[model samples]
Target: MTLDPEDEKILTLARSARARNGTAEGAAVRDETGRTYVATDVNLPSLRLTAVQVAVATAVSSGAQGLEAAALVSDAEEPAQEDLAAVEDLGNAILFHAGLDGSLKGRYV
Candidate 1:
C-alpha cells in the first residue's frame, strides 16, 4: 500500500530498528498527536514482548491517549494476535506490515 510520508517515516523507523537490533521484529507507532515510538522485540529472560507491544506501551507511558497508525517490519506472515490486541487497546489504527527489506506487504486494522 502507498503510505503517507508520516506513515512512511514510521515504517522506515521500524525497519531501521530491526536492522540495528538484529531482532526478529521491529515496530513503530504514531500517536494521535503525531508523536512516534519505535521498539524491537524484547526477549530478555525476565520479560518477553513483541515489538508492537513495546511500541504501544511506550506510547501509553508517554501519555498518548490514542494512536493514528502503526507499522511492523518482520518476516512473519502476520503480526501476532497479542500484538494486534496491544494496538486495539489504544484505538483503531491501521497497522502496516513490511518486509525486512522495507517493502510494503499488507495492512491490518
Candidate 2:
C-alpha cells in the first residue's frame, strides 16, 4: 500500500538509515529478543527515528522479504503479539482501498 505523507516521511528516515549504516544500530538485533530499546529511543512526539535506527526498522517492516532478512540479521521476535494482527489488517485495508483487492495478479501496484 502507498504510505501517507507522514508515514512516507518516517520511512524515508528509515531508508536513509539503511543507506548510511549496514544494519540496525545502538539498540541491537536479536532473533529471540526482537527490537529492544528501539521504540524507547525513537518513541518521541515527533515520531521520528535516528537515521541509523530507521534503516534497521525500515528493513524489518519491508514485508515478506524483510521478514526473511530480519530473521537473519537478528532474532527480533516481530512486532508485539497484538500489533501483528493490526499490521496485517492495515495491509489488507490498504490493498482493498487501492482497488488491488485480490485481483492485482500481475497488474503491478
Candidate 3:
C-alpha cells in the first residue's frame, strides 16, 4: 500500500533507528497531537520490549492521550501481539509494518 507523507516519515525514522542500533526491530508512533516517538527493540537481560511497545510507552509517558498511527520496521513479517496491544490501548490506530529496507509489508488496525 502507498503510504502518506507522515507515515513515510515514521517508516524512515523506524528504519533509521533499527539501522543505527543494529537491532532486530525499530518502531515509530505518531500521537493524536502530531508528536512522534521512535525506538529500537530493547533486549537487555532485565528488560525485553519490542520496538513498538517502547514507542507506545514513550508516547504515553509523554502525555499523549491517543495514537494516530504507528509503524514498525523489522525483519518479522508481522508485529507481536504485545506490540499490537500497546497500540490498541491508546485507541484505534493504524500499525504499519515495513521491511528492513523500509518498504511497506503489511498493516494492522
The RMSD of every model to the true structure, in order and in angstroms, is 0.7, 14.8, 0.6
The per-model lDDT (C-alpha) reads 0.94, 0.28, 0.95
lDDT of each residue in 29-85, candidate 3, tens digit only: 999999999999999999999999999999999999999999999888798999999
Alpha-carbon deviation at 1 in model 1, angstroms: 2.2
Clashes in model 1: which pairs? Answer: none
| Ten residues in sequence with the least summed lDDT for candidate 3 | 98-107
Q: Give the per-residue lDDT digits (tens) of candidate 1, residues 15-59.
A: 999999999999999999999999999999999999999999999
Which clashing pairs does model 3 show?
Answer: none
For residues 5-105, write the lDDT of model 2, one tens digit per residue: 53333333333333345443222221122321122124458675532243345435643222211111111322333323322332321111111111111
- Candidate 3: stretches off by over 4 Å: none
User: How big is the positional error of residue 38 in model 1, measured in Å on the Cα after superposition?
Assistant: 0.6
The candidate with the higher lDDT, 2 or 3, is 3
Which should have the higher lDDT, number 1 or number 2? Answer: 1
Error of 3 at 68 (Å): 0.3
Model 3 earns a TM-score of: 0.98
Q: State residue 32's C-alpha deviation in candidate 2, in Å.
A: 30
